[model samples]
Target chain A: MTSNAAGAGTISYEQAGVNYDLIDPLKVAAQRAAAATAGHLAGHGFTEVKASRGESAYVVDVGPFYLASIVECLGSKALVADEMGKLTGRSYYAGIAQDTIAMAVNDLITVGATPLVVQAYWAAGGSDWFGDAQRAQALVEGWKKACDTCGVAWGGGETPALAGIVEGGRIDLAASCTGIIQPKERLSVGDRLGAGDAIVLLASSGIHANGLSLARKLVERLPQGYMTPLADGSLYGEALLAPTVLYSPVTEALERAGVRPHYCANVTGHGWRKLLRHPAQLTYRIDALPRVPEVLRFIQQHAQQDDREAYSTLNMGAGFALFVDAADGQKCVDVARGLGIEAVVAGRVEAGPKQLLIEPLGIRFGDDDLQLR
Target chain B: MTSNAAGAGTISYEQAGVNYDLIDPLKVAAQRAAAATAGHLAGHGFTEVKASRGESAYVVDVGPFYLASIVECLGSKALVADEMGKLTGRSYYAGIAQDTIAMAVNDLITVGATPLVVQAYWAAGGSDWFGDAQRAQALVEGWKKACDTCGVAWGGGETPALAGIVEGGRIDLAASCTGIIQPKERLSVGDRLGAGDAIVLLASSGIHANGLSLARKLVERLPQGYMTPLADGSLYGEALLAPTVLYSPVTEALERAGVRPHYCANVTGHGWRKLLRHPAQLTYRIDALPRVPEVLRFIQQHAQQDDREAYSTLNMGAGFALFVDAADGQKCVDVARGLGIEAVVAGRVEAGPKQLLIEPLGIRFGDDDLQLR
Candidate 1:
């Protein structure tokens, strides 16, 4: 933070390092403590700018148009081996980039935002040179491929090396996307919604990406056939991995059908509860609900968890949810089903203060301070 | 972190809570642990997107540009303050963004590129609401101003909340930046530099965001005046917080004059040693270097360090370096000095392995042995 040949507007990075102009010797000493790392600086080949910094500040123009959003995922399933036993498992970190890309693009579909560049980060415990390099190159390639799948281009991304900060062989993949919408076509929270609006449920591929930490914990403590039963009754890690479902086709169908949803969201973490964040005072009545899959039942029964907790955490077999007028609802569902998803009319919208009532499941969510707060 | 009935994506902020996904059965316990701190998520209206995503990806529209490189001051400047009895200090957290953005952009400038956005993040610590929010806002505002000054735009950024993973009141700012450049207009690192090339030093502030952990330890044990003196005669904190000199104007002139350099780099940690990262195998000989500032002299005298060690670990007044042809060497120096920065016909380019040898400073640095193994 010390400046030489200083004048006004001559700021530097030291101030940003948390070192003030206070006269304390020990503070300087403390800041220098981590300089003894084992790895050497990346060899000066052709001016290797750090990948992390490059991703943050560098903007590229591959084509025209105010591009679209960037979608990404952390490939939590990769952590199965990372958090559990590393030896008795396979080493495939490449799928994470694809999953991360899928997660980002899926969100893009909701906003009608086309994606452009997809980026990610990969962290490892001990740098397995061959393995790590393969994973890095493969991850970038997969992300690019996924962006292409969404009919977009993958600009660039980052792969930083944080040696000591992250220890247990963990590489977290998170993404930030940017997209645009025609001002008139943009969706807002308070779009008009009447009483006769219908709810459409898109079938889920088991548990999806959320609630795995709890599911694994509960399954690990349950009986052999408790979570994922096999022929003779065994566990199912694949069931838990349930590759993320993308609704790009649904986007196409809805657009072609000229259907405009009053409200929409990707049923990800906490499933139906995510809808509440729209911040409107409306009651959702589920007179007819989608069938719950076996995986969720196993998790609930084995963990002895209540229905509220389960609904607030797992997908409950519905990958996505949409609320449209009753007149257009059947058509939307038909179009979704035509696109291969098990879409069906499930519920309706009513007047209330942000409440969700399920008479059949005997579940009354949203009003309980225990849940909302 | 969640999705809803309508296909348009929306989610409640609470759904994105780290533990909302059953990552911890003892979520209540975990939430309780995360509670009782400042730095809480501040609710604010998200900025409206002003451009398209595709073209928006690269904000740069034309040919010539510049760059800055950034890396978090991983050293314990914060710990040094904690040891000094000021645990609640806003600390140097905000300053990290400056370096992070600089680190990214400086590289772009080395090859001649213009920055687009300055994005950064911090791993959340004790939920210090006021402290965290103020710092967060300050960081964004600072970055926005920096980009604005440089004729670049500031795209939105990320801020992750990690409670238990980090230490008490400590946050790690992960910075990334994106920039742009034209293929033809980019400054190729292969310009002619005969035996009389100029190696100009764009003076540095003390430890401008690097090698702080070791610095604090050594400075703490020194007698006095061993660091920058603060507004109130405090000798410790001010020097470390001194900001780095930005090399924006000097490089801009080079581009304007169409003076492509044989090599260039932001003088950060490892000082002249990092110059070898440049392409073109030649001996970069520096002469008539500027006087080492008091900050470095203090560290040298107090730590009983040699000039080589001092420059190796500290910028010693030079924040950015360049290698221009002997033909344009004087012009380069004249242009730099005209811009109020002291420059010298400091070096030459001779046939040899790509390397940097500052004979006057008695130092040698290169990117030869530290290959990615």
Candidate 2:
């Protein structure tokens, strides 16, 4: 097993060549442009939920239901899977497919929508990429299994063999899901979120799809690369490639238990900073934090990132967070536990400046760290 | 203008690295897996339209409305736009954006669904790809304009900068669309077509999305490359970058005119051979063919392909095909003309072996040419 005492220089997501400063501005500009085109939806008898513009999912108002749609891609994790496959003589594509579906469905549930259908966008460098029957069959079976897990149909998708744009021997996996929010009361875009809402955290299986660019970078510095064993005696790449937890069941069960969260956030991309995802000007002070997975701990130690940097860039141990009435936090946690997901009441919302504080770790993230809009 | 007499070695789609023989079987396998998952849709209170499995779009029976969804990507055309931008000092991203949206929406209408919302999937090699403000703004503006043209909302999308998977200096564009098929009778999946149905051909702008790999290869053989001027005085790359036609309005107008086609085929991927996209075995005999676009004509002359290969691989001139009752053929043409789209009754379906006979070009395509299922 790799030792934590071997110090490596500090690294950030930007050093891994993923600079949010350069990427977020274009996203904000696109959101502004997209807002102007909402009127076109009215012609089809469906209206855009204007508040859902910068949310994790885009919601539309149909007469009887609110439809939420999201597009998400499993970023660069497949590269890690490819490398690990070459080393282990086992295909990780099944889990890779789960990661792709989970990336989309998890975000769709954040808007309080139940996923109905998922369409895939599998673009490869060349047609020969599919010539590997083992990898292809594993991908197909995994996609079907993921759809079965999420209760969404595996709708058709595009498989374009893009030779020049995508790198050879690599495939870019993405999925778009359309979900429905019935009764219109289930739409959670943070409008009902108040200062006293309790935050319930759901445990993650491991590092999900986000921040993989940096994770892949860390592998290059390790002597054993993907084969490096973690503190738990699992290969570094195997732990990283653990299939993402399907959180839709938790939300679905919560709704069935007669508990509606004031707000929900899929802790992805920006990591713990996602607790402040809502536009409401409130403080999120966390008195407790979930146990960081061994893999994430290993990454933090090898990367030499401080507590604040690690929490803000990786999921740590929390895969999802739900804000509900102060009294309903335990019930939300119980419902998640019933679904076999580890859960805890990690924090509460308060009336203050827009920021998040981790009391245990003595970490603070100002609002500027995440400028999605 | 460069003359067509200058001959180059013959090129095929396979030589350009897109081989359907290697790609289509996986699609077939995926469809089989997808079919088994249709039972999952029952939990969402929506049933899958089994007949739509192999069609251009996937349809779901959502009680009051049949929902159709499709995922499509602009293959290597954006690469062409990138090279042309370097040579001509102009941003072709606006048209490239249209090509992406058109590629999806055109296919959506083939199943008689009217598009409601379109979400984008823009994957770049790095965050710096959006550093070019002129190109980014053109892409944004073009997306909004195309949505307005198709009367669909511009829903939120994902723009992930994939560092290692995608090639630097290039971007891959894809989109997924959710459309509504109201009244149920408007859904056309080729169940109504038998024989004596008139085939109406709609004009294409130029090489729209498909066959771009082969077209891009032709540019390499040209001394002027993308700058080579055709007989029409338009540069080769400029003509190839012409935006795809939005056929949604044509289909919507046909519905309003009370003339639902027995079937419709988006002339993409499989080219004119898409006329047999229906699972039913029928002979499509054409007495007339539309004029080949100048860019396509130049491609045929340079690549030295016979009529059968060109028509089966490229759209040539006809971008879309509609098979309707003989009596309503002129009405469909009139409706398209009202919208300024050139249309003609080019052929009729006959009771014979599954094949397409082009009398004007003496070209024949058997069922083996296209096995989308």
Kindly report, for each predicted structure in the order presented, the TM-score of its chain A compared with the true chain A. 0.70, 0.96
Q: Model 2, residue A25: displacement in angstroms? A: 3.3
**Taking the tens digit of each residue's C-alpha lDDT, what string does model 1 give over A272-339?**
67545344577878877676766767666655556766776677877777777788888988898887
- Best candidate per DockQ, number? 2
Output the lDDT of residue A177, model 2. 90
Once fitted onto the true fold, the runs of candidate 2 whose alpha carbons sit more than 4 angstroms away are A1-7, B1-8
DockQ of 1: 0.04
Candidate 2 chain A lowest-lDDT run of ten: A1-10
lDDT by residue for model 2 over B1-373, one digit each (tens)? 1223234567887777687777777788888888889998888778998989989899998787788887889899999999989988899999999999998999999888989888989999989988888898898989988998999888889888987788998998998888888878989998888799999999998998899888888877889988999998999999999999888999989988999988999999878889989978899999988888999999999888888889989999999999999999999999999998898999999999999999888888999988788
Return the top candidate by lDDT: 2
lDDT of 1 by residue, B180-240 (tens): 4444445334344344566666666566655554455454355442334534464565556
lDDT per model, in order?
0.49, 0.89
